[model samples]
Target chain A: MASEAQSSAPDNLPLVLIHRIPPFELSFKSWLPTRFRLLDPLDPSFSSPQTQSLVSSVRLLLCLGPSPLTSDTLDRFPSVQCVVGSSAGLDHVDLATCCRRGITVTNAGDAFSADAADFAVALLIDVLRRVSAGDRFIRAGSWPAKGQYPLGSKLLFSLVNITDNQTWWLFQLGGKRVGIIGLGSIGSMIAKRLEPFGCIIAYNSRRKKPNVSFPHYENVMDLATNSDALILCCALTNETHHMINKDVMTALGKEGVIINVGRGALIDEKELVRFLVKGDIGGAGLDVYEEEPEVPRELFELDNVVLSPHRAVATPEAFVALQEVVIANIEAFFANKPLPSQIELE
Target chain B: MASEAQSSAPDNLPLVLIHRIPPFELSFKSWLPTRFRLLDPLDPSFSSPQTQSLVSSVRLLLCLGPSPLTSDTLDRFPSVQCVVGSSAGLDHVDLATCCRRGITVTNAGDAFSADAADFAVALLIDVLRRVSAGDRFIRAGSWPAKGQYPLGSKLLFSLVNITDNQTWWLFQLGGKRVGIIGLGSIGSMIAKRLEPFGCIIAYNSRRKKPNVSFPHYENVMDLATNSDALILCCALTNETHHMINKDVMTALGKEGVIINVGRGALIDEKELVRFLVKGDIGGAGLDVYEEEPEVPRELFELDNVVLSPHRAVATPEAFVALQEVVIANIEAFFANKPLPSQIELE
Candidate 1:
């Protein structure tokens, strides 16, 4: 069911429009006035005329996804003040049209970074420890017959180093090089967490941000070559698709690990399989893949890969935070105050 | 192969007898005397007169296991000076026989307590969080699949009042009720480690020690009833066998977890399985079993159990420490010194 906040723009209605919301977005009343209409951008019933009718009543539009608004749709909303998106990427919104109409635009930027970082750490531990393999062994009835499975490799065991029956010395996370593919919101937060673990953070983004503390690499291969763990948190634009191909995988070395919490299309799936099979790279922790609903069955066969069901933001805390921020941004636009996170045309 | 230390004791040299061990015993050198003919009262091999080759050369008899010396074995080691046992349980050794023979008896009272405690805590987290389940999911290729498997529970899914992210807040061990079955060396160490986590530690043993900081319960059911997590770190003696039976399971409440890093016989497996199936108890983490190498397949099928192959002390560090301690205990007996731990005659 559509969230009630998305369905009705209440009486003191400052005239707001919203679209491209999931079924369970944030509760709007907690942070914003009820005078906001958060439209469903992907609503099957939406037509050209209906889009125009909805836009005509709003002073602002909270757009999500990559749906462009045509001139006719803009004509109905003469009082439109701004267009805000609940996503970081603004490719779908008609920035030129909004600028012509003097409508400002903003995007939800860097909000989901910590959630993604947490997921990266979880996946990394899952892969290294073979946590999943032990579970399968018990279910398969191979445990008691075989006694305990042979001790898992000490290389991947992330827990403490136990000794003398009482004192436990934990493994240190400090002093490892971490390669970030995209230096965006998620990528930066990942570096922040790793800092306490004593990691030397490095990044290979499309354009380097000067104000950052991590070393930047212009070449992804160089970053992969130097890093002990390579993280993929970049945007999936056409120019950066399948950036982690066979050549990049080869450069990662046999001891290096790869983590991807971003879009699956950003890595070369066949190349990853080949590298894993050949032991060219140590391990991989992936939350997303090239294809949804059907990942390569071979990925499951490898002991070094940690796979999750695209659930980095599946935590209840992140889910609620997502809704709260999206609704607040929408509300801010209608009231003619500064939007929570505004996007603009270059 | 048996550990090297087990095989190196000189058969023709002065004999050192270690008798009266606990139910769970490992052959480690925690006593003194670097070289001697070591006699184990609990060894099935000790029954035959053919094993009495050290009758003439024996100088010291070290009591380690709880098994008392039978007249046949004592007659064979006439030159023995000391009978030292490195266990709290003196059930296997005859203290009167040693006293009559004018042999000093020693015990290794609490060397393994802290390690056992650490093991209990690890098992609890492993079972409840489904660290094993997550491992199995990846191995089965059911990850990220729709209608696949019961996903592992997040860390803080049951906290009563917490606004912060449960995942982050509950990941660390703090503010949890941890119940100890026996307030022995291991149980006390568990309480110490859990104390830093803000855990309220409680114990149910023969009688609570006056020096311990943790609270005491009169019965096993009371301990289970009050604990958020009940840890079985007690020895498998007559009074404690099957202590956590159906009634204790019922008292533990549906949210309480049980961890048995001690002897598995302390918990009733049949009742545990029934409780797990009916959702009558929260969960359990087991290392040892009532019957070794004969675990039921049904236990693996349950989501509430985490099984370790009785290898909690199998860490390389622990192995090294065991070798050192067991060797020293044996050597001290040969040197005519006071044993590290002495067992009092009942």
Candidate 2:
């Protein structure tokens, strides 16, 4: 009853459109400020003529979770000038339509960066150290039946380089060369976190960042060739889709590891599976997949691979941070101030 | 015949007794230097009068692995002035006998510290972030069937203290207060490695380290009370055996985590299992157990627990570093030089 009364607020407050599926609506409503008059499409009143007229007058839309903000949806709200994204990636948003309509877009920029970077490192260590496999081995009552969980590759201060011929020979993480695919907030956080571990950081981005000192590789192939591991942290774009193809995998060689926290399609799933199965590459720690929620069945049996449901950014702290960012962006827009995390459409 | 000739080398080189079970003998032989004439007990010549005389003349005994260097074993080697340990922990050695004989004992020292420290951090991240559990969820094809893998606790920055009632709520690793047990080489390395993650570190050791700055808790319970996590990295000694009992674990409380890179006996296995099963503690990342290779079956069912079969020091890099330390200690002992990694048997 309170929410119903609040939903029918006066016109003094700016109208904001809340876009999310049924499951996430209650949670979003719980944190969102009641000062702003909210218009949720899922409401029964949304189909009424009066509510439709009200939605048409909305100036801001809050994109929540994985809800799609397609062109058709954008066409409904003719007066919407800005879309505040609650997630870091904008792949689900119809950015082209937003750009055409001159709609400003703001994302949950650095809010998820630290958590995502932490997950990236967690996955990397899991793959290299065989954390999950060892857990499985011990869980299946293999410790007593088996003498030891098979030794994992080393992670610090070792002389040998991993090779297909020498899978058992471990190398240290301290001096290993790591190539980052993107140099954005998440990527930079990952690099900063890993620097203390003595990793040799290099990266490949759209352009060389003038102030950054990490070695720059002009292309993914070159980055793979010089790196012991390639960490995918770049946003998924037309140019980046399937960028880690067969050639790049080949350049990464037999002993290389790949840690992907970016997106599933950034890597050629078939090629990656083949490389892993054939020992063409050492291992993989993947949080995202080509078709997530459906990881390749072959990976289930491999001790060298570590797989996670696409949850690199799904942490309680991250969710709270996301809420803060979203609210900050909305408040800034309403105050005629610059959006806190606005993304350039170009 | 070639092996026989090599083992029967002239008196010019220092004679070192190789003590290990059959399994590790070959690996030890592969890495040991040829400059020293090695006497193997498993060899047929070892029981012969000539080999017995040769064994009696040995000045250094190289303990290849977990082979027991008992008081009786020490008595056979009347001239053994130094016992070269090939492993980081020297619990297998009869230190009292070595002390009485004025025999210098040298361990792997800092050689295995880096790898062990790395593994400790890996386990901590894996447990707190549910890295291994998330891996299992995806690998089991639960992502599609289960919708989303559960969100893990935060890792970079968050402000929630873990409590029994809030077991499912995750917090970031960045600002958690971590208490280190032992604060020796591996403990110090673990602290150094975690500092970049923004963890506040305190420690408990035999005595308050004068030069160190971390708050020293003289008792384990006090350390546990103040810590969000307790990383066990101390050696197993008479006083430290079962150091982490029910009381200390209770002090750590429901939301605290325990990471063990030390010997299994450092924690009371039975008490640990009870605490974990009852949800009296948050979670654990265990690489060692009381009766290793015989981990508690109850731990296998818990998603919060991560188990590795005593592999914190089993990496190839560790093995190589171990060889270097063993060689250095032996060379130094023979040259009338101070043993590089000598342990005081006080």
Candidate 3:
């Protein structure tokens, strides 16, 4: 961890503890006072003396990545004014304990919307075009000679007549059914992006979102059966786990494509593999997997699927947004201002 | 082949010798009233009598793949009118001999444009996202239990202060610079697709065409140097071969990405491997290679590059277009009408 620049805050304000992440370095340097320690408190072990130090000076705690915020850990930060999570999802942070302690909690809301949207589209195109497969085919020394290798298929071919059609035609995306699960910022952005592509969007969410163009479906099965493509952009929770199982897979179109940019636990991985292998549905593009890092080898061999290691919001823009939001939340707590991105805890 | 769907053409007219390749059958059921044969002309020991029978029957010879068209071979088809090549590039067919014999030639123009464009865009996105590298990392089993792999850089984060300024905001085209070479139909479509992502389109061609909105660079060197991402969509002829050699490569940006959907001969492959190894360009995506089927094995080891096995036009739509166009030429010749897509033999 780098040394704190210099404190810009008054002498009476409680200190904030933030773990230094990449782009966060720039935001912390820009917005916060020098005295704040952007250090990893999880170093070696969280000892009693270190806990006492945190309790003595820290008025706010900033968290990023997968670091845990247990009640035991938070108890040491006695002077902590608030907890700010630098991510839209707050699964890692224990919100109930913070709420009980009367500690304000905020998050970097909607910061990753563009990154997620861009990646979702990227994954969709990648899978449809078989980009990864092409790369592998070339790398494996099986590249065919001229007039030997097969040409790629076009997306429009699936929509329009290619034979005996003399007239130039554009594909119709309008009236094409698209389903989105979890209508959060990422999903909403995806819906908006699809508008230009001419797909009719439907979503399944616990609550209907107002001021959206897409229609909402109460049942995941209904959405699944009706859509040409199903997008899983929802967060994973106990209720949401395995939301897309064998039944949902059966409802999708034979030529339909599925894209997942959210948590993998929301999908039944074994079923997805089975369905994909049997061509139960068309194809799938996944950025997240049920098992992280260890993507099933079978997925790689399939021509109808595209896979990316869980990195939907891993763009530079998202990182910068994350940094800015985290610093703002920390600064607000120090100056007694309302936190920018507030979160509710059970 | 499948007995020529009963032709009704007069016996006195120049017989059209249509040799349809076996296994991958060409549907000539409704093509025309013509004399056709399923001749294995590609066989090295093909009999001269069979050739003579073809030459005597048809004044026009339509060849699908690269089978040598010699005067001696055509002598058998004395009444043959002309030769129509099925593909775009006339590398396989002898254009000079066709011109000398007063034989008109034609090819399927713009048939693979959309497929090629779609592929170029897919490669660009894959290279930018490091999707290929992520796949390699997981397969290599270097994944850590937690935070073991470094977070790959995103397209959006490279911008300095996009949040503060709109100029920088537009700079993230899906989030990067996209440079195109040869603003032909495929190139133009690529630019159009990228327009939604706010890409700054620039190109270098032999001469600029009219009505194009994007900036044009007269010099290829300048285009290569200025572009953060480069795509080669130019045609292959005397002038284009080895155009992207060492000098042009040197001009490209450090983080530049290259996608070649055009002819493999357009780029100097030896220079490209050297440049990639030296990290002159951040990454590359290629569908065509200098030597067909025999791509440099070193490209496999490089995590930065993505290679496709010349399958850009292998799509179902493109294949259907190819079929329709080939049939059109045959029909036009028999009907004594103008060919839809004529290729002038200079």
Candidate 4:
């Protein structure tokens, strides 16, 4: 390492560090305030001794995307006072290490809630109504070849008249029993958005929230038992990992659908695939997978499973909102003001 | 024609006429009340000389699907008093003849409304969010090949920061202005469903609905001029036929989306194809075509448009509801009770 004297004099502007891996750099550099000098490790001078000295003095770090911010990485920037996360889920960040180090953490809170909730509803409708499957059918030049696509399940009321050759039915959305997992900001928004569609809402969370009228279940299994659809909106943690196993899925039964807008590891992907393959579960609308960008090949041919490229929070509107929150957190940190959306650390 | 003397004696049950072309017979025959004797034209007895005399005394006709109910056909059943239409749209029936003959018409009333509204919303979301396109991307194994799918339009706010190397964006649904054509039951329900999504709702109809608060326009052009999306929910009548022609589509502009859940002729299919092909309008989610089962083949390759096989009302639940309404109408007609879903002949 070069001597301290080799480093250039610090500018008057406050210094901020940007932690991101290659090909995933921050795209909102111009949107950030000019009052801070952003130190990017990917820069050409990053390996230089003088630049390393500057890196050690980075008091504020902006963690963009899934860039790992492990304890060892944090050790290089010993002066990091606050870590402002630009993504909704901070799984990449070692939150426990940050908490132990007494470093404040902020995330993009409520900024992506609306878009995520909208996507969850979209996925549910897509799976239930077979929107994507119908699109595929039409795209394959199969409409003329195939007289009509198969019908989806009826919404709630059952009028099953089984004749030898004919059956009369209706698939509605007016009264579906929807069980929401993790009734947080995103979950509550999902519930509110689905209310007008006349869906019956229930939830399974860490604890029953006060002033909420929706029925709450202590366990995910019980929630699945009563719901026609289960929307996963909870954060992934040690407790929630593999929470949706075979038993829980079995309880949801053959007519129950699953919509996941949360993290992939929150569910047992292998079990989900098995259940889906066996036709034990009604359908699934997945935006995330256990090993993303590597979805099960078995799901490729299934009509009931709708696969998305983890794009629930990929809306342009959500990004603008996220940018606002990220900027606010940065400004608040520099101005000695409270952060706009700090994550509560346990 | 057979003489009255050659006609067989009337059965104890009331006689009901079923005017359906071959291969399109109603599947709810067993569900029909045993009190009425259904007279199917395809019945082998109908070719018999005495069957013609029996047909003349039929007072109730059940028109199933799109079977033509022309005046010439009605003339064969001169004693027909009530026409119970099992389908929602009455375009196939000669309403003029029905009115002239003072024949009351009952249709599948609110039976199919919920499913239609649900489908309308589903189509709208699919078009706006590009759910079908994204699904296609994942299904074709393009996610790993192509890192990110193209971003859709921003929901409401504008943040155009186009750098030479990088750009930040999001496509949102929360703040879209949705214009509903035809403020009837389906239109109103579509508005109600989209309200929770933070969508701004407006409408165009023949007459302004009382007790309604949404901004209403008398002309569809004015409605399309200000809307990001136009949801066609009006009945296809002479006045409304091709109402969404070139002028209205042009006014909807480049970023506008069209969702048709109503009859196919409500829009000029030829004009729509040109607009969609030229990128004059952003996208479409069409369930009905001008000559359905024969959609414009051009739309098959387009990524923006979502083509559904006129399946908005093809759900089992809708069929069950339709069976209920049909049974109710038939029972009421025989009981001299008020028809459950009568259509007023204007």
Lowest lDDT 10-residue stretch of candidate 3 chain B:
B164-173
Put down candidate 3 lDDT per residue, B233-265, tens digits, no spaces: 987767788988888888886667789998788
Across residues A128-167, which tens digit of lDDT does each residue of candidate 3 receive?
6667766766676655532343432222213233443211
TM-score of chain B in each prediction:
0.71, 0.90, 0.79, 0.90
Report residue A95 deviation for candidate 1 (angstroms): 12
Off by over 4 Å in 2: A1-9, A26-33, A148-170, B1-9, B26-33, B148-169
By TM-score: ranked, best first: 2, 4, 3, 1
Across residues B1-346, which tens digit of lDDT does each residue of candidate 2 receive? 8887667655556788887655454343344546776788998888988778787788898886666788998898899999988778899899989999899899988988887888899899888878888887777777788554333222111324323324344456778899999898999888887887778999999999888999999999999999999999998889999999999999999879999999899999999999999989999999998887788899888878899877777666566677677888888988899898999898
Alpha-carbon error at A317 in model 2, in Å? 1.6
DockQ of 2: 0.40
Report the C-alpha lDDT of model 4 over A267-293, residue by residue, as the tens digit.
899999999998899889998888867
Best-to-worst order by lDDT is 2, 4, 3, 1
Tens digit of per-residue lDDT, candidate 2, span A1-346: 9887666656557788988754454344343546687788887887888777788689999887657789998998899999998777888799999999999999997888887888888777777767788798888887677553344322222234423424333446777899999999989888987786678999999999989999999999999999999999988878899999999999999889999999899999999999999989989999888765688999888888988877777666676687678889999999999999999896
lDDT of 3 at A136: 69
Instruction: List DockQ, one per candidate, in order.
Output: 0.11, 0.40, 0.19, 0.38
lDDT of 2 at A109: 78
Per-residue lDDT over B39-94 for candidate 1, one digit per residue giving the tens place of the 0 to 100 score: 66567876668666554556666543224466667666777666655444443465
Which is superior by DockQ, 2 or 3? 2
True contacts kept of each: 0.08, 0.44, 0.27, 0.47
Candidate with the larger TM-score of 2 and 3: 2
